[model samples]
Target: MADFNLSLFDTSPFFLTGIPGLESAHIWISIPFSMFYIISLLGNFTILFVVSKEQTLHKPMYMLLCMLALTDIGLPTSVVPKALCIFWFNLTSITVGGCLTQMFFLYIFSGMQSAILMAMAFDRYVAICNPLRYTTILTNARIAKLALVGLLRALLIVLPMPLLLSRHPFCANRIIPNTYCNHIGITKISCVDTTVNRMYALVAVLVFVGIDLTIIAGSYILIIRALFRISSKQTHQKALNTCTAHIFVMLMFYPPFVFSTLTYRFGQGIAPQIHIMLANFYFVAPPMLNPIIYGVKTKEIRDKVFKYSCRM
Candidate 1:
C-alpha cells in the first residue's frame, strides 16, 4: 500500500502526475491555436447570429443549425483559451476543481455536437427519404423538444466523465503543464486505482461517438437506397444536393474523433507532445470547420448569409 503512503503520492503517478519537460515547442503551437480560436468563434457566431436574424431560417433545419453553431462555438472556446495561456503566457497552475470544470464543459460540448449532428442527419433522412413527413415530423415544437433532450442527453453522457475524475484525489504538486486539463489527463493525477473511471471513459466514447456514428451511417444508408430507386434526375439531383453539407460535416467530425481516441489510448508517453497537439486539434477543428463546411455547401444558408451580409 505504498501508493497510499503520503510521500509516495506527494503527487500522483510519476508518469501521470504532471507533464514534464517544459520546453520551447509549446510557443509554436500556441500561435496557431490562438488564431484558430478566433476563427472558430467568429465563424460559429456568424452562423448563429445570421441564422437568428433571418425569419425565413427559423425552421427546423436552421434551428438545429443555430443550436449546432452554439454548441460548436463553445467546444473550442472551452479548451483553447487555457491551452493558449499555458503555451504562450506560461499559466501552468490549475486547481483540482478548475480542472474538472474544464473537462466537464469540454466533454459536454463534444457530446452535444455529436448529438446535434446526429439530429441533423435525421433531419436530412426525413427530408430526402420521407419528404412528405418532413414538415409534420420536424415541427418547431418537436425541434425545441429535441434541443432540450440533446442538452440533457449530453449532460447525462458527459456527467460520469467529470464526476469520475472528481472522485480521484489530487495530491499536492498539481502542475498540469498543458494548455488545459483533459478528462483522462486529470484522472491520471489520482494517486489511487481508477478502473471505474477508465471504464466510464471507454463507455462514454462508445456511446456518444460510437452510437452517433452508427446512427448516422444507418441514416445515410437508407437515404442512398432511396436515391437509387428514384427515377427523375431532377429530384435525385435536389436530394443529392441536400446531403452535400451533411456529408462534409461528417467527414470533418470523424477524423479528429477517431484519431483522438486512439492517440489517447496508445500514444501517451510515446510521443507526448504530438499527442497533446492532436488533442488540442480534436477540440478546436470541429467547431471551426462546421460553420465553414455547412455554410458553403448548404444553398439556403448561403442565400441567408448573403441576405444578412446585405442587411449589415
Candidate 2:
C-alpha cells in the first residue's frame, strides 16, 4: 500500500497544454505569437539601446524606463520560446525542475515589473510635484538603490514559491492546461492539500501588487492636485503629457493582470482555454506594447529612433 501510494505521488514530467480546445490551431497561432515575441524583443532592445546612447535621457524617469524595458524583455522571454516550441514542434513536456525554473523566472520578472512600475510612478510624482528637488531627491545613486531594492524584493518573495512547490509531490495527472507553468496552475495538480499554497499565493499578490497599486494611486492623486494648483494651462498640459506614456503602460499591464489573476482563482465557470489565452496575453501584451507606447509618446525616444533609422 505504501509503494502504491508512493507511485501515485511520483514527481513525473508535466505535459503543458497549448490551448485547452484549440490544439488544432496551435501552428496557426504560433504565427502571431512569434510576431509578438519578435516585436517585443526589437522594441524593448531599442528602448534600452536608445536610452544607453542618449546622454540627455539619463534622468530618473528615463532610468526607470530602462528598468521597465528590462522587465518587459524578461517577462515574455521567459515563456515565449518554450511556448513556441510547444506550438511548432509539439514539444509540450516539461520536467519538474524545468517547470519550476520557468515559474520562478516568470514570477520574479512579474514581481520586478510591478516594483518598477511603482518606482516609475514615484518618479512621475516627483517630477510633477517637486520639480525643483527632483534631481537632488532622485540622484543616480538613489536610482541604483531603488533598482536593487526592486530586484531583491522580487527575489525574496518568489524564491520560496519554487521551494514550497518542490516539497509537494505531484499526482499521476501531470498535465497543466496552460502554455507555461505558474504557481496556481502547478499547485492545482497536487494530490495533497494545497490550502497553504493557495493562501501564500493570495498573500504574495496582496503584499506585492496591492501595496504597489496603493502607492501608485496616491502618487497620481498628489500629482493631479499639483497640476490643478498650476493655473497656467500650458504648464498643466506639459506636466500631464509627461505622464501619458506611463499611464498607458500601466493600463496595458494592470487590467489584464488583475483579470487573469482573479479569473484563475474565482472564475470557475470560465472556459479553460479562455483562461489559458488570457494568461498568455497577460505575458505577451505588455512587453509588446510598452516600448511602442513609450516610443510614440516620448519625444526623446522617438527622435532618437528616427535619428538611428536615418543613419542606418
Candidate 3:
C-alpha cells in the first residue's frame, strides 16, 4: 500500500478545493460566479463587435478599448469555466500540464490587461496634453504597433513562468487549495524549494505591474495639470468626464489585485476561504465591470450599443 501510494503521488491529479470550508455551498456560490461570467462575455463581445463593424470608432482610444475588451474576455474565460466546473460538477482534479496551461493563460491575460491600461492612459494623455499632435502621434499604424508590443511583452514575461514551474517535480502533495491554478499555489505543493519561482513571481509583479501603475499615475497627473490650464470650464468638465470610465475601471482592477496579492503573501492569519473568495473576485470583477462602465460613460460607445441593440 505504501509503494502504491508512492507511485500514485507522481501521477495523481491535483485536486482543487473550490472555496475551502464551504464545500457544501459550492452550488450556491456558483450562481453569482456564473452570472458574472455570462455578463462579462456578453459585454466584452458586444464591444468588440461594435468597434470592429463601425468605421467611425476606428481611433486610438477605441482601438485601445478593443484591446481591453479582448483581455477582459480572455482573462475570465481562462479560469471561470474551470472554476464553475469545480463548483457545479465536482470536476476539481486537473493534470500538471493542464494546470500549467491554465496558469499561463491567466497570467498572460493579466499582464496584457495591465499593459493595455497603461496604453489607454497614454492615449488620454496625448489627447488632452497635446491635442494638436494626438492624431499625428497615435495613428492607426502606431496603435497597432502599441498593441503588438504589449502582446509581445506579456508573452515574453509570462512564457518563462510555466516553463520554470514545469521543471519542478510535484510528487509529495497534489492538492491546491484554490479554485484555479496559480503560480504560487502550484509552487506551494512542490516537493523541492521554489524560491526561484516565488522570486520571479514577485519580480514580475513589481517590475511589470509596478511600472504600469507608475506610468498611469504620472499620465493622470499631467492630464490634471493640462485640464486646469484650460480656460473654458465646459471643456474641462468634458475632458474629465471622458476619463472617469477609465479611472473607474482601473480602480476596479488594481485595488482588489493589491489586496489579493498582499493577503496571499502576508495575511497568514486570515481565513483561507476569505482569501480564496477575494482572489476569485480579483479575477472576475474587473472583466464584468469594465464594459458596463465604458458603455455608460463613453457617449459614442453607448450610442453605438443602443443603435446596435435596436437593430437586433
Clashing residue pairs, candidate 3?
none
Give the TM-scores of the predictions, in the order they appear. 0.89, 0.96, 0.95
C-alpha lDDT of all candidate models, in order? 0.76, 0.88, 0.88
lDDT of 3 by residue, 93-181 (tens): 98877888899999889888899889999999998998999999999899899889988998898888888777777756688999999
- Candidate 1 shows a clash count of 1
User: Can you write out model 1's per-residue Cα lDDT over 184-283, one digit (the tens) per residue?
Assistant: 6665656678788888888888888888999999999999999999999999998998888888887887777778777777765667766666777767
Better by TM-score, candidate 3 or 1: 3
Q: Model 1 — TM-score against the truth? A: 0.89
Per-residue lDDT tens digits of candidate 2, residues 221-306? 99999998999999999999999998998888888888888899999999989878878877877899999998999998999999
Report the alpha-carbon TM-score of model 3 versus the true structure. Answer: 0.95
Worst 10 residues of 2 by lDDT: 1-10
Winner of 1 and 2 under TM-score:
2
The lDDT of model 3 is 0.88
